[model samples]
Target: MTSPTPQAPVRRPTAADGFVVVDKPQGWTSHDVVGRLRRLAGTRKVGHAGTLDPMATGVLVLGIGKATRLLTYVVGADKDYDATVRLGVATTTDDAEGQVLSVAGPGAVEGVDRPALDAAVADLTGDIQQVPTSVSAIKVDGKRAYALARAGESVELRARPVTVSRFEVLAVRQVTATVADGGPDVPVVDIDVRVTVSSGTYVRALARDLGAALGTGGHLTALRRTRVGGYDLAGARTLDELEKQADADGTLATLPMAEAARATFPVRELDEDEVRALGYGQWVAPSGRPEVVAAISPSGELVALLEDTRRRGDDLARPVLVLAAH
Candidate 1:
């Protein structure tokens, strides 16, 4: 009897080069989603625009394949969230995942009514200095702040400027809540808010600040990011949905790189010569817009991200990132 020949391993088709807005589930870190996407896309070239806390759930913009190059620009876009700020209990991590630090007495929360809450929200709105939660990704002397905090080291982060464009209180409720591991109840006020903030703003910090302004310590109990720049929950797909698509057709649906760039940036339609110039690492005429512009080829392909630069007394646009080769 002749020995049977072994068959080669089957390879799945790679996913298209584009962006995917994932409806990130709670308790999954942004990196966790990327790890899963790498398998689904059959490519390791996956990146995310911003990091979402493991406890947070909502719109997480992911870039796959060539679209990963565009996430640098996407990270600067504003974000929106619906969050619940619990006033009366302070936590070590400034969220429900942390240990209870302090619980406010009943009298403290009762003083924070609608008008007072509104005033506090207004104070936090617009441009303000905010101290981020100690347990954050911020680096302290080349070490992550959260790592230091977890190691029982004191982490005092400096306040930074952040813009809270919209901070509307949707509802307020007074209820008894458990503040400790054991089931002892305390009176607390929970304020639901819809917040639109600049790229670097931290909603958990906002929750903490609101409580401090109201004379009650506070922490974030719930956080759901509804939007990240042009990407929103309406267009997001769950991990299971993506897996189903991949399993059915060996690929996941994604917004093409050109479409993603056009939607997120100012466009500069390039002529043949300009397209050739960018592809060859040369400069072209300035688009006159100060912001980064999406340089598009005549065939509607995204060529590069162009920025105006003055060289030899003439203003010209240079390729910050060349996406498509001519």
Candidate 2:
């Protein structure tokens, strides 16, 4: 008789509320990270603010316990990426992982110099209409676009407005490349770039458009996200690091929900009287800052997320989400 495999010990749930900034490894899906974290954090409430593609690697923000409620606002924040776009080849998925669609003729990609590349980059900067890559996670009629595309369905997505606040070329390299469509090796120009764009902007789509505009088909070869809203690589920890930390003492360095709120939104410290009224769901006077503001107690606890709105004719800062009990 064979001995059964040793089962791992399951840690008890702690239900601690906070966020974990993970330096997501390549090949691990966003859900894959969350599933692993569910085990490490000793809770099933682990959730991420944004989904990073398996090919992309960098900072991925995760929320624990009640922190999941704050992820919606985080999803709307701007993003930054460091990507390499190879001008000379196009791919079915607009990235290196996809099969090549076409290859540029010899000397075609080389003809695109610094000035030409800059002009193309300029054209992509600022607010522009962008069609998300077909393999993206966008949903069509409730089915994920990627899911449909993977199943051999033709996907035609529409263009939408997105702001590319900054698009700067960091370096350029000239070399020969192989085509994924089984074509002969061709000369290619690889342009390394960094972009800061509004939420929902597709960097892969930008690579496709950049190549199309230059008349020398292109696709993303590498992508690494450096920043997401207020959270950046500087604050991130690797999954291995987190796992070791968890094993050492069943603990993690989580950003408390109040600190996370303050990091993402401006604060409005409330007095004792306002705190009492807010506990009952009553509206308080406006705190000057527009949009969603974090309402904190003088003692530094985040009480709720508040928004100023007009009720009848009077303006009041109503509680959008109450975080604390009386």
Candidate 3:
């Protein structure tokens, strides 16, 4: 019997197709934004660079069509957050979302002056191992840590190395509030902090660690991501604005793939031949830079991600991601 006719390979979208930076609203999960974008863009190929907690609001880099290749690079870049940490209480999730596990009495944490807070923040800066919150998205035994914790399982995550480039206390205030159990009143000290940390670093963990250092419980009250790599809230379009633009033009507001890559990383321009070779996933000569750089064509099109690989005495460079031909 004759075999069935060979089917043609599905054609993927081109690098010209990329993502839009969105200022996600509170209570909307990252997946929710992606779903909206998929409908807005009239395409199913939509993804985000990173995941943000539902309570967090800030810049979320999205990838459209073939630009999804850029997510890997974006995900590894440094991140910045402006957050509020509430002292005098600890929670199961390390944030305002979870149940209160413990409460320090009113004025339990006095004498936490600005100087002391500054010193605490200083100690958190630089390279350190951080234990992610039990309710984090990290997977344990192929299941999300948060899922396990929610199921009443005791989760103990190991500390992982992370870099906190900056941790500054912007403001601090002490306030009184009633507990959920209708118990006696309590005093809570709220600290506003701005942090810049490497990938995988948890802002909630930072708050928890800070409280641990101060001998008082703490948890994140609010968090707003300000920056992700080169994308910042300054350039993000809100969902309402995005919907307006989509309705007005019947086309989604998307950043060009080449532009996105260049904005996020250094660029190396390639000639027509090099571009062709890259599109075919072939190797090229080193550009003398050891870092991974986005390779673009003369016409402002992203061709591939190029990086140098050294083996013995030979230095070879190759494309990590080959974008579709322009």
Task: Give lDDT per model, in order.
Answer: 0.91, 0.90, 0.86
| Number of clashing residue pairs, candidate 1 | 0
Would you give me the overall lDDT of model 3?
0.86
Candidate 3 TM-score, true structure as reference: 0.92
Give per-model CA RMSD.
Answer: 2.4, 1.9, 6.6
lDDT of 1 by residue, 1-326 (tens): 99999987555577899999999999999999999998888888999999999999999999999999899888999999999999999888889999888889899988787888889899999999989888889999999999999999999999999899999889899999987668789999998999999988988889888888888999999999999888899999999999998888767888988889977998989899998989998999999999999988889888999999999999999899998886
RMSD of 2: 1.9
Per-residue lDDT for 1-326 in model 3, tens only?
99999998543222237879999999999999998787777778889988999999999999988888789889999999999999888889889999988887655677567777778888899999999999888999999999999999999899999999999888889886565866777888999999999999999999988887777788998999999999998899998898788777657768898889888878898899888888888788887886898998988888888899865677777877778653
Question: What digit string (tens of lDDT, one per residue) describes model 2 on residues 137-174?
Answer: 88998998999998989898999999999999999999
* Model 2 collision count: 0
Better of 1 and 3 by lDDT: 1
Per-prediction TM-score, please? 0.95, 0.95, 0.92
Which portions of model 3 show Cα errors greater than 4 Å? Answer: 1-16, 310-313
lDDT of 2 at 148: 92
